[model samples]
Every structure is written in structure tokens, then in C-alpha cells.
Target: MNRKTLVLPAVIGLLAPVLAACGGTDGGSDGGGAIAVGTTDRFIATADAPAPLDPAYAYDVGSWNILRQTVQTLMIQPRGEGEPVPEAAESCTFTDTGNERYVCKLREGLKFADGNPVTAKDVKYSIDRALAIKADSGVSALLSTIDTVEAQGEREVVFHLKTADATFPYKLSTPVAGIVNPADYDKGKLRDGFEVSGSGPYKLEAKVENDEMVSAVFTKNADYKGALTVNNDKAEIRSFKDADAMDAALQNGDIDVMSRTLTPEQIKKLSIDPGENVELIDMPGLEIRYLAFNTDAPGVKDKAVRQAMAQVVNRSELVSKVYGSQAEPLYSLVPATITGHSNSFFNEYGDPSTDKAESLLAKADVTTPVKLTLHYTTDHYGAATKQEFEVLQKQLNASGLFDVTIKGTPWDSFVPAQRKGSYEVWGMGWFPDFPDADNYLAPFLDDDNFLKSPYANSVIRNTLIPASRREPDRGSAATSLTEIQDIVAEDVPVLPLWQGKQYVAARDDITGTAYVLNSSSTLQLWELGRGVSG
Candidate 1:
């Protein structure tokens, strides 16, 4: 969710006539070299929705990605493909003592965007504060095993874990671990974010809801050291509410970048050439969408009833019709591209049919029609979700086993309503905090998991996650993740539907845009510059 915003003058010397002809009399297009990026809708980071100024509260991946551009992780993940290597912190390793303590030494001369030195205490404060505020912060759950974070020296920070948590490094790599200015954070209070502060390459200039965000280069910051691929002297984030509007702005030269909303067709149409003009990249996304059956809700607690509803879902048709073949058909709760995904669910329930659904319903003694409600977010995700639910309704009705009702709330209310267990069945999607299978299983499989869907399997809850956390080996972790996936499929708390894709469309003038990292979806800002000779 990190955005690279730039505010600078652009030289429109020769394009003045062109701008005039296109009705560009406003001062938005100026002299120098600046680029404007566009997205659909507004961004609200309020006390109620409180987007934390610190990374510890960074539960929103989008928000963290934006913060990543403004700050630095102890280890920066590379933009291109490969296992993560060290970035800001020179090297990191666990202590030999059986206490399972891990330590990271900061790279010397790393300063905040405001010129304050980054120290070991800053790191300790960043993590501990998140844990301290976990009652209100969604991010505290991610650091569950962290027993204590103590500053060892001016340049070093040590983490004492409750147990052998191998994923601690990966958790630290998340934006939530982005180092903050200790001066801004209080022991247990949210900080004011209007004045921008961080050690990243860009400095915040303006952030108006649904309007635009602007940033300028932090020229004196030594931490940048040209590590970033995008160093677009300046960056701008302009919001829009619809794909068509976003498309029009890009085409009219009002926006230089796009995220999320543009469809495959829109991207194809915008690209002057498939690999050239418009940068088109389909990265392996960490997001998985499915129908969550609130097992605690009446009637759905029955395994047969859950299986019956899951059977009635025509995932193939849902992908083809709702997603226009842009998304892949998902069978396991985990998507196939992810390391641990398996086809166990597909193997068990191959296709949608009344016979299979009715058989399961009959086993549950549901001879009479079952009435169910499916909930979704109206403005979130994409337009296809509504149509996807409609198709679900039609498919379930076609089975003659259930009568269904579909409801939707705006994205804001959607989360709260679902958490209150207000829906019998609802469609939800998860974008991993980190690109790992454990993130997918641990959050959803545990009985006392977040979202409280009452979907839990003792094998997954108590056995699989603990084993994977303590395995201490990459190969073992992958195998353990796969086993957890199998157990999740068996429990049938959530039925996999389809995996989502990140689609971006750009005008022919934008270059170096194709290589942006898909995991964070944040442009390096420095890498984006004017195209080959205008």
C-alpha cells in the first residue's frame, strides 16, 4: 500500500499547444519533469481506521507497502525474483544460545528522512510498541512469539522469543518492522501523521483523502545509497473511483501509473505493444479469495451442509464469468502458485452438480431447503465479486437444495459486520502480510483465529502450525505447510474459489515501470522516469 509520491515542476515547453488543445489550462501540468500516478477511490487513514505512522501497526499490506517506500525494513526484499537477502541491516543471524534469541546490527549512517540517526533503541521501540498496543493494533498477532526486544548497543537490537520461531526474520522483513523515529511514538498512544518522518528516499509533501499525495526527494538521506530501482525525482499519487475514469486519465496524460482496478482487456488496449509502451506484468500474488462459512452461524455448523454449499459452487464458471478468465480456479484454500498449495479439495469435490450437493445435504438431514445468506463488500475487491456472488446464488438455487440471499456493505462496514458474525456465508479475500503459506494457514485455521469464523481443526490448530514454526528448516517448513493445507481442506471451514491478480496499465510514455515489485505493489519512485526521448 506504499505509494511513491513526487511533487516537482515539469517542463511542458513544446507540449503547451498540445496541452492547450486538450484543455489543460490548469497549473497541474507544469515545467520540469514530474509524473502523476492514478488509483481508483480515496484512501482513509484515520483514528477509526487509523493507518499507523509506525510500521508495527501495519496490518494493511497496502498501507505497509506505502510506508516501505517512505521507510526501510531491516532487510529490504529485492524488486525482482529471488530469496530475500539483507538490505538496511548488513547481516542478521540467531544466537547459538538455546534461548532462541535473534539479533540484527544496523548499517552505519542510516538516518531518518529528517536526518535523525536510526539506532538499536528505535528498533526495540518499534516492535515492542506494536506488541504493547496489540489490543487495538491488528499487527500484534504477527509477533505472537516475541518474548522481548532489548537494545543491546547503539547499533544492535536483540529479540528473545518465547519459542523456536523460525519465521521471525520474515516477520521482521514486513513493513511493520520499518524503523520509526522514537521521538514520535508514545508508550501506548497513536502518533500524529500529518508531518511526514522516516529514513526512506522520499519526503511526504501533501496527503489529501481521495485527492492526491505528493512527495519530494530526500536528497541528503545516505541510506538511499541508490539501492532503490525507482528514483523518479518526484512522485504523485492521484485517486480515482472507477477503472474507466482511471483509464481516461492515463490516456489523457493525467496519470503515469495505475494499480488494482484496470482489467486485462484495459491493459491490453492501453499497451501500444505487449512488451513495450504500456508495462504489463502479472506477478504471483499472495491473495486468495473464497467463500467463508461462519460455522458458528446456525445450520452451517453441519459438515454435510458446509460440504453441500461448497459443492454447489461452480468455481470454473465463476472464474470464467465473474473474473473473465483473469483469475485462476482455486481448489485449495492456498493458491497453487504458492509453495504449499495442493489439489486435495479438487480431488475430493471435482465439479459443481446437484447430485453431489444433494447427496451431502441429505446426509446432513437437510431434506427441506436450507436458507442461507452470503455477504460481501460492495466497493472493495472489484465489480466481479458482486457478479460472482450472483452466480453463486444461481448455482445454489439450481441445485434445488438451498434458497440463498446475497447482501453487501461498503468495504468499511464490511469488515466490522463480518467480525460480528453477521453473515451465514460471506466472500472474503486475504493478501498475505508476507508471501508464505504459513501466513495463509495460521490466520484462518486456528479455532481462536482472527475473523472468528468458528472454523478450526485440532490437527491444523495445534499440530501443523506448531510443527512448521519449530521445524528450523526450509524443506521441512514447506512440507509442513502442505500438510496443513490438506487438513484445512478436510475441515471445510472455508471453500476456495479463485486466486486474484494485480493488473496495472500505463501510457506509452512511462518506462521502467514493468519491473516494479508485485509483492509490495509500491513503485521505487526513483526507477520511474521519462520514456525514450518523449
Candidate 2:
């Protein structure tokens, strides 16, 4: 994919990947029938919970991959563009100078796959219903700033914000903003079962599930009205329990393309010497991994204790031994790609040093050999996690400053463990809801934070965040953003570990794998086709 420097409406810097330019000079790929894609990602809440296809309840990559193809948002990031272009709407903008009031006018003749009219009222219902349900596992926190949404006539929709938020436009481009048919979705509950009625290029033709989503079949919707181009007539998405199965599926020609949850070894193999018919496509990755501390937990509650542990963990060594070439060391909350990125952790804690850690603990009068448990998910993150945590245990134990125990839990249970405070410190990861400095910092700082932390700083929560959000030009807010990182480094609520590099492995003949992810990193299945691009 060709990289383009795009300055978004908020004036933040982005290295957007141009899929259109790389697809072909004439633009787009040759006509194809259907493409089968495979992954080892989990989408549903559980076997007994709501349907994984419901946009209102879905939050993970597996769910978003399907939702982004079938559902249409008010605005969308065009192929490789950082800023959003109108999709369901003809145009959208902030009407007020304070950036508190936003307005959108619907596109003419828009209709859902079910042939239902796409109206402003349905838009209101979609957003309002999501907020009303407010599922703990849902995307409510992302839209917490929205105070209310109202429909004006049949074409216009107005969003009233609780406070100034200049980056609201980027948030609208995410899959959580995906619109659904009001007649099908519940008002204050998640719609169970796999049927989906959307307005995007494809409809969920059939969805199969056993314990989790097994497979889903999507076919292009003739009634669909949107800005996206449908290159293939149909797309089949398959799920696997492990990377080995997905990798074998790709190798055996059972699946056309495989992504997400590819092991580091598999990535290395595909990157170096792919099979005769295989190809590797690399894209900029914003996914980051870190360890979040339960600030109230014993042995890790002290600021000095957290800082001492941070001083000893070598990020470079961790990534090298655990992730290999697939990841790089991360030193701050915001990724290096976004504006206002800082290496606060590196600046504060230079290299792995036991002397420094020992001194800090001594000054704080902390007891030696602090007992701690490091928790990681056995299934959700991938096979590398158990080894990653074991390496972490070795590093901490070698310092002789802590007695560590490593524990593994399945994702379905790991989520509940965090809520129950089952672990003192645990592995957590984030692929920004949208690419912005605010997206990285705001969620953790706010009261509705996903951090599950007792750590609080008034300056970060009350001052720096609000000040940054008030600035219309996000780049100008760099001072505040950097200050937030600096403060986080000092506090050590979460210790940054590593940032992943994105790679997509596919057969050489498959087209638009480079174009699959838009500016926001949501998979656009319509971009995929059988033959090479024109």
C-alpha cells in the first residue's frame, strides 16, 4: 500500500495508507465471485448473550470486521483517507464555534438491505438505543460525550455534546456508530441471534454459531445505498480457535485471505519466503499492549512500588524475545504515528536497572521481595501471551525485588476477573477507537474509564483532557497531550510494553488486501476481489 500524509479536519498528522493508488492505475480490482477470509478472533460476548452481529453490543475486532462491511455510519473514512467523507449523510459538520453542536444531512434515496427507508429518526434511534443499553462490554464509553441526538425533518440529524470535543468526527467513522434498522434492533437491549439488517454494501446472508461465531456468509445487497464500492459479489468469513488452523487454511487454499491472530513465527515465515502463490502486505499498526495495575491491590498500591517495577522491565527485551519482528517497544500511551507522541517512559526510566529500582523501594520504605501475580488471557490474545508473561515473570524474579506468579485465564473469564479484582496486575491491549492522542488518553482518565483503576489525578482528569479537547486544531493541543503522558509516566497506572506492526497474508492473486482497512483500521470487505487490480 502507498503511504500518504493526510491532515484530518482536526489538523492532526496521519500516515494514511492509499489502497486506491495501489489497487490499480485505473482504480479497483477485477471482478470476482466470493472471497473467503479467516481469523482466530472472538466476536460474541458468550454463548448465552446477545448476537455477535449487533453493532450496539459488539466491541472487538471480530465483530467490527463484520459490522463495518454490513452497516453504514453517518460518515466514513474513504480508502486511505484520515478524515471522514460522508457515507449515509450528504454532509456533516460542527455548526457551533465551540464544537459542541454537530449536524448531518442524510443522503438522498438511502435504504437498508431490507428495503426500509434510512431516515434521520432511525439514526437517532440507533445512537440513543446504544447509549440507553449502555452494556459494560459495549461501546458506550466512546460516545459518552454525546448528550442527546435529535432528528430534524426526515433528512437531518443533530447531535448535542456535553462538552467541546473537536475529534468527534473521527469517532463517527468507527464501527460502533454503525447504523442498524430500527425495526430490527431493540430499544434498550442487545438483539440476540445472527440476523443483521444494514445499509452498507453487504448483508449477513447466514451466520453460524456453536459456542462462538463459527462462520458468516455475506452477499452484496442490491438495495444498499452507500459510498463504498463492492468489488466482490459475496464474502465468506470463517473463524478458527487457533492460528495454526487459520494458517493451514490459508496454506491449503481453503481461505483466500487470513488476518488477525497470526503468530509471530507464522508472520516471519510469510514475510520472508511466502509460498509460490502467497503474498505479504504490511500496513502501519496502532495496536499497543500494556500492563494495567489495579491501584488498590496490595503490594502494588504504592506509587514507588509501581515505579520500581517499571524501572526493571526491559521493553526491548520483552518484544524481542516474545513478539520478535512482529512488534516494537512502546514507551507511551499514544502511538508514535499520531501527533503529540512522547517517550515519557523511556525518558524517566532509561534502561532496565535493579539499582534504581532498589533505591526507589528503599526510599519509599517498601518491603523487599514484593509478592505479585501477573495475569494474562490464555486464548484471546494469542499463543504468544503465555510465553510473554513467563518472560515477564523471569525478568521480575531475576531482579530479586519481587516474587512473581503467572496465571492464565480465557478471555471470557479474564474480563470478569478484571471487574472482580482477581489479579494485581494484568495484560491489557488497545487498538485506538480512532487514531488520535485524545483517544489514547481520555478513556483511561475519565470516570467512565476502562482502566478499572483507583488511580486518579485531578490535573489529568479535570484539566489536561478538557483543555486538549477544547482546541479545534488537535495538533496545537500537543502541549497538553505531552503533559498528560508525562504525568502518566510519573504515576505509572499502566506500564507500556509494546506496539504491534500490522501484516496481512494473502494469496498473490487476491486483490485489495492492501485496501481492506480504511483510515480508521476497520476492514472494508468490499475492497477484496479475486484477480489482480487493473
Candidate 3:
């Protein structure tokens, strides 16, 4: 859930002008010939290339992107929008009035890339294995409501939940629920390496590893029988050190497509550079960047201290100065694009108030020049992150009420360190598992969540969430979402910073930029192709 995923930009008001000004074009081949797509050459060992392409263990965006291409889930968010449709399953539905039981009927003649039959047993094994391994970064928490998964005959899979959960189907759409061949993977532990056995549009042909980097080659899976259409026979994905390098590769024809991590300035440059022959696809802004406070850390243990910290920070300034127009101020844990989202923080604290912050600190008996350490990942959250934190440091220290020390570590070390409570306050970014407000709430606030900080709220976790899940009508859960937002604003365990716009730059010859992005902001590799005309 904390992974930094890629996205395709949509033709929207914010980006329409940019696209028009740039003489925006589509990606397609000239007539009929093969096309080669390239990704970043720089990959992080932990975040990008941690091995075993097992859906149960793949957590980061890089891993998920590969899994999305190769694995077949019972349901999927096709083109990344709406409720998930049947992928491996011919049909899926909730059977009982309480909504506790769910069932799926497998599609006929389904087979893996290896030409092995895909049965209901494989579906049961996949879910069971994910729960059993329980990797720290895995999506087991999303399935916590499931009590049992059983296969009925060869084509049917049934799930019995401990409680009613209307959002259960959405979980099935994520890569965590991807079906794997039981014969090729272990049921009790993570699969050993990068080798993957799946039933999707593409199959992994080979992988090349470099220093701190990995590149994968995927060919069309002849046995693929899913909703996705394979436009190209093959694709090559590589990791890059940063967006600039990725952009350079794309401009130089070293790569055919570029997604994720492009700075606002880079995007602006691309927008006006007609000679680049790159099409910029704009997508909705659903990604959120936030600051998480370790409640156990000194100088932040007091609730008043946390609230004061929130009051002093200016989200608008962060967006304008650091993020430019690529992001917007986010005042709640849930972004405005999602249903049930509320600007609770804005209502509670209003604009940046030095007087109010000082008053709150006085009430907590906090002395001026309160010393604190702020931590962030140097490489993970993009190049702007360092500048963003520096801006925050200056803003917090400007009041003469705080002594802030900025600390940064690479993502590999940063994730574990933050989870272990090694940082007092830190920055984190989230790409949704699904396009729902519940995703924003559950992952950060659930019991023993990814935050790994000593913080808990019974009403939000034990009460509001379960109540919301039981509500058959998702819109009716607005009351619970509003209450949860209000509670989070009051507690200020995590400060909502900003939400980002998605951008994907593809060569003019690439045809499917429009279809590459789904609602979840995940790029569909199969949708990309070179037009024969190019």
C-alpha cells in the first residue's frame, strides 16, 4: 500500500492545455512492425527487484506492475475504473443477505502460461498461501475479514467471511489475490526468486540483473485467456535512478515509454518540447503524500504537540513551492477525488496559525525550541522530497519554536527503520490498492498497520471500519468516513500533505496510452503498442 506506483495521465482540464500546447500525439506503429518499450534502467534492490514475483509477496509498485501483467486474479479493475469485473472467474457475487459469503465461478478452458489447467483449487491455494506467509509488506491485512476459503468442485471458489464486508470484492481485484500454480510455488513460504508462473497476458521470458538494478523481458502468453488484449508481442521493463534519467532515455529513443517520478519541471519541459515527439497522458490525482509522527517519540508524545505541528505546517506552500501544479493540497487522509472524503483538517485548524500553535504548545507545557528529528527516504519519494523536507524544516524552525533536524535514508533501509520506530517523524507516500476512501483509512489506521508506530484508535479501527464494511450501500458509509476523518484531524497522528497528478510520457508511435491507465492508477503494460503508421 505504501508503494510508489506509476500512472497514465488523462485528458483533463489541468493537463489538457499542456497536451494541446505540446501537440499531443498517440502511440502507434506506422503500419505493421514490432515495437520495443523501455522502462528505467535504475532499480532499487528492495523496492524494485526483491525477487520471487509471487503475488502474495510483491508489495512495492515496481513488483506490482510486473505482477499485474503476469498474474491472473479472479477480478480486476480493467482500464483501472469502476467495480472490478471477472478476470479468471466467469462470475462472482455475494450469496447471503448478511454479505458474509462470496463465491466465484472459474472461466471455462482457463490455463496457465505453462499450459496447466487453472482450477478452483488453485484459487483456494493462492489465497491460503498469501495468508499463511504473511509477509510484512504483503496484503494479508486486506483479507483479514475472510474466515475461510474453500473450493467447490473444479470451477467454483467460495469465501466465508467472519463479518459482512462489501469491499471484499475490491480486495480480490488486487495482485495479492492473484492465482498461482500450486505446483510451481510453495504453500507455506515465499516463492524463492524472480521466476513467476502465472496466467495473464504476458509471461516472463528472462530477467537481467545489474548493480542495484533489474530488467525483465516479457512475451505474450499464448495461453492467456483474460479480459486484457495483448497489443505487443513483448515488453522490456527496466528500473531507473530517477525521473530525469528516465526522461532522458525516452527522449533519446533509448526507451519508448516513461511512467512515474517525473518532476513538475520535467513535465513542463515535456509539455512544450514539440521535438521530443512524446505524448503526455494525464490521470486523476489520487496519490497522497503525508507526514507520519511516531507517537512514542519524544517531543511528539503529547497530543497537543502533534496538533501544534499540524497547525504550523502550510500545505498550500508545499504544493506551490515544492510540488508546483503537479500536486494539490490534501487536508484529510482521504483525497478529495474519493467518495466520503472531507477536509476535516482545514475545518479544524484553518490556515497556518502561529498564534494558535504557540497557544497549544503553552497548554502542553512545551518549551520553545522543541528539538525534533524528521526522517524521509532519499531515493524513494522522488527528487522533490529532499527539497520538500527542507522547506518543511525551514517553515517549522521559522517560528523560533522548534529545532528541526532532517534525516534521510534510502527506501530499502527507510521502510524497515520507520516500521521499527526508528524515526520520530517521517514522510510516506501511498498508491491506492483500489480507488476507494476505505483504502486511505484502513492501511494507515488499521491495527498494526504499515505505520508501525505506536498509535491506535478503537472507534476508527474496531467500530467505524467494521460498521462501514457492513453497510451494503457504500455511499451510506459517509457518516462513518466523516467521523473517522474528524478523529484523525483531532489526533493528528499523520498529517495530510498533498495529492499528486499522474503523468505518463510515451513516444508518439505508442498507440494505447489512453488505455494503459486503470482507475487504481496502475499502468497496464499490455495496452501499449506501436502503430504501424509510425
Query: Which candidate number maximizes lDDT?
Result: 2
Model 2 TM-score (2 dp): 0.93
Off by over 4 Å in 2: 1-32, 45-51, 532-534
lDDT of 3 by residue, 247-331 (tens): 7788787877787677777777766662446667667767899999988888798888889888999999988998787899999
Worst 10 residues of 2 by lDDT: 3-12
**Winning candidate number (TM-score):** 2
Candidate 3, superposed: residue stretches over 4 Å from native: 1-52, 210-213, 532-534
Model 2 alpha-carbon miss at residue 319, Å: 1.4
Q: Is candidate 1 or candidate 2 better by TM-score?
A: 2
List lDDT for all candidates, in order. Answer: 0.64, 0.80, 0.79
Q: Write down the TM-score of every candidate.
A: 0.85, 0.93, 0.92
lDDT score for residue 111 of model 2: 94
What digit string (tens of lDDT, one per residue) describes model 1 on residues 148-199?
Answer: 8888778888888887777677777676676777777675865545344677
Deviation (Å) of 197 in candidate 2? 2.5
